[model samples]
Target: MAQATPAKPFLLPAAIAATLVLCGLIAWMIESRAVILREGTEIVLQSEPIDPRDLLRGRYVVLGYPSQRIGGPLLDPLRAEIGEGETIDDATVYVTLRQGPDGYHEPVAVSLAEPDEGLFIRARATRVAHDMTWLFLDFGIGRFYTNEHRAPELERRMREGALTEIVVAVAPDGTAQIKALRQAGETIITEPLY
Candidate 1:
């Protein structure tokens, strides 16, 4: 007698689709909480949000004028040279000569080429279907809280029309920090995680 032929098992396409969907969901969740960490020296700095594309090594935000916290003469002659077309060198650029007792970020030495500043800055970038926009603020990483819920406090200050000042922290290597805003009589770097 002839032996009976074995039949092939059927595959379920629906189960495969479900597995793919689950994987996509997990990837999206993890990406939502990803943080980009940029660090510098121990100093508290404030930033004004702008387009992220506007920032780079050769091109940077000005410490004084337009939106200035420290009102005084240009501490460094180089400040005048940082126009739209001008290219900053690898050396440090000093904007403010001295810092107030409150220890706000005053302009000391600003270098257009490197992370010469003592404060680490932070921002958020979002991508659309065909374009990308970034929330560029001059504020340092110290300003942002790990828990985003506290962001209201930052908004409240802006709403209340609080007065702000700029100060500087000078490092031995000639790195200068330009802090745009800070609390009165408050110092930022008593302790830092980095």
Candidate 2:
């Protein structure tokens, strides 16, 4: 009878390759956020608290920004891009922000093309109004995870009008990550770069 070749050798190499791939993927994710935290421009945004519950992901605070909706001058560029009888939805847009006297960054302009200068956050248009006069945008920085014990207290303070805000780091390309949470201009929790 012919000798059977062993499967152990192939199994060992496959398992090793799989583990290496996983490690590389995890490292890439961590480094991407770290780059933003380390070198990006910092901006503070006024936040509104929403629900704080997730059975699978644990407790986290959901944040809403007044700047989420854009209209008037801010929508002009986007409006000009839409052709007659054409609808725009789920398109990438860059929003230039100017800091108000209150130290909160507000949307100053929105463009289908990335701004050559100015601090802007990249967002995807969730939907364009029928009149093409407004765009609802998602910045993708709306969630802040916290420990179970702290989640409730933070939400309560926000609900009771404690003036909560989020400190975000925005990369040159407009990618952003939450760097810290603030209450009345005081830093509450700082995210680790890892």
- Tell me how candidate 1 scores on lDDT: 0.35
Candidate 2 per-residue lDDT over residues 1-194, each given as its tens digit: 99987667688889999999999999999999999999999999988889758888899988888888898877766667766767768888899999999999999988888999999999998988888877888999988888899998888887886847899999999998999988888988899999
Best by TM-score: 2
* lDDT of candidate 2 at residue 26, scale 0 to 100: 99
In model 2, the runs with Cα more than 4 Å from the true position are: 6-11
Candidate 1 accuracy as TM-score: 0.32
Q: By TM-score, how accurate is candidate 2? A: 0.92
- Candidate 1 structure quality by residue, lDDT tens digits, 93-112: 33323333544444443323
How much is 194 displaced in model 2, in angstroms? 2.8
Off by over 4 Å in 1: 1-76, 79-86, 89-96, 100-145, 163-170, 174-182, 186-191
RMSD of each: 12.8, 1.7
